[model samples]
Target: MPVLHALKRIGVLFLATAAILCTPGTPGAPAAADEPGWTAEPATGRAATARPYFYLEGTPGTVLEDRLALANTTDQERTVTLRGADAYNTAGGAFAVRPATESTGAGSWISFGAAGTVKVPPHTRAVVPFTATVPPASPPGDHPAAVVATEGGREVGVRVHLRVSGPTLAALTVEDVAVRGKGAGTVVAYTLVNRGNVALAPELALRAEGRFGEVPGRGARALPVELLPGQRVELTEPWPGAPVFDKVDLALTVTAPGGARATAAASAWFVPWAIAARTGAGLLALGAVALAALFLVRTRRARREPPPDGAPVPERAGQTAPEHELTGTSR
Candidate 1:
């Protein structure tokens, strides 16, 4: 009877271990590639989650409530700092979050119920409730933000997409354009500004013409910059093989998403000073020689031709004109 009881106990222990090993993990708690043990996500709230980002839409003066989930998959506890920041596209066109120290626009509007710092036990999640209040005079468009978590020098975040309800205006401007240098070593500089309430990936088309309507350099290229709302960036484009000696008319046409367009122009004179100086000197020398020849020709003609009726011809030192010639009478 002792042996039978021992065998039954052993079988029960084996079954219990097997069951524990076969259990599945919690849904949506999968670890990310960059952050192996930490993950931040949006929790259940008035906002809707479409995959990895949260979408919240409301009118001005409205308050939207949401929650952020910070999960720690490691065996040790992790202390993470939480904050909100505005989101924007990188130069490579990838979506990214702003720095923790900066909290403007949608980032400033977010308020959390818990402290800025939170600690989560091993294999547990910390839920933080947050509210985003839209200002009464907020512009209508998309305002992106994120709830970020930083732990042990590693940071993870979940995006918050806020759309204010009103008319959407997309405006942009190009200003302060100029052309510098000469010939093949020229540069076209300009300033691109976003005047509306949205981001822009601007496309540039450049055209340069000489004084005689000759196209010296023309091209269309896309800039690797993401201009944010109310932001301005000074950029330059290399213009090789530009005209060497002519008045150049440089025009830049910038276009972006949402039908934003602007055109700016600048004119510059590209003169080779060394060559111009040499040519001018040669012209002046030729003019001096031509004036000297004209003076000699007038002097010789006066000596050969007869004097006018009332004009008197002066006599030489030891010679005198004949009386018949002086009286203009035939001999």
Candidate 2:
């Protein structure tokens, strides 16, 4: 009972263990053995596109447990047989028929359903649960396998592969940082995004440019950088002025599990802000007024202009109004 209980997970699979390879089918699927009174319709089922597919969680390989679901998608009594199911090779995919390898081990971890059985009813769906096991010592990589079911004389089979991708680890992605600044003691800000799958402790070492309003001669400094998958962190560093440097470059480095590393960097423009000069305030105000005026003029024009015929209607871009009306479609 305990063994069976452990096997109930969504990732159950079965290994062939070089056992007596038994594949059955009927007349419809002649590819399968000749089973009498059994007519199989097309083995119709949707591939599980998300995790927990086939009721198994992690990447394939480690003796996952699951059952392929195939329903009678046609009228009249039809039998669906799974005979010689396996990963479709590149060549096989061209022909639309996959080549599958039988599994080898049942592993001692779990057992969710019966290893071998076949009998599908008309108008109903059948579940072919399977288990996958990654040899404890097996190297991490992609390994292929398949399951076979048979019904009728001809065979209607689906192809699936066993995956043996190695260890589970998180990944980190650092995005390019943007900065605006110039002059001494200027601070350039940047954002770091974590694109990996794992979480990371927020910490990083900083190294950035000192020329062109950059942190001059700056060494590594600690930045609080805790983040997780798809997370981001913003950082700003004060510029250290060096007479020899006109611009500064900001750089950061991060370390994670399995010796993985991530980095972000930014360049500080050397353009001196006019705000540092007395005329800077007046120039800033003038620029703002000009922008506001431009915005107002654009708005007034939009409001005053009218369509030639009826009220302007929203249409898909690139399509003319008459073309859209006639076709009842949008570009």
| Predicted model with the maximum TM-score | 1
Tens digits of per-residue lDDT, candidate 2, 136-223, equal 7654432333344444533443323333344635456556565544456556565555454433443456675553343434455444
Query: Which regions of candidate 2 are displaced past 4 Å?
Result: 1-166, 181-185, 210-218, 237-245, 271-331
Q: Give lDDT tens digits, candidate 1, residues 86-156.
A: 76544323345667566677977777756688888999977777788889998897686766667776666
Off by over 4 Å in 1: 1-55, 65-76, 86-104, 120-129, 152-161, 181-185, 216-221, 271-331
Worst 10 residues of 1 by lDDT: 18-27
Candidate 1 has which clashing residue pairs, if any? Answer: none
- lDDT accuracy of residue 174 in candidate 1: 90
Report the C-alpha displacement of residue 257, candidate 1, in angstroms. Answer: 3.1
Model 2: residue 77 alpha-carbon error in angstroms = 63
Compared with the true structure, model 2 gives a TM-score of 0.29
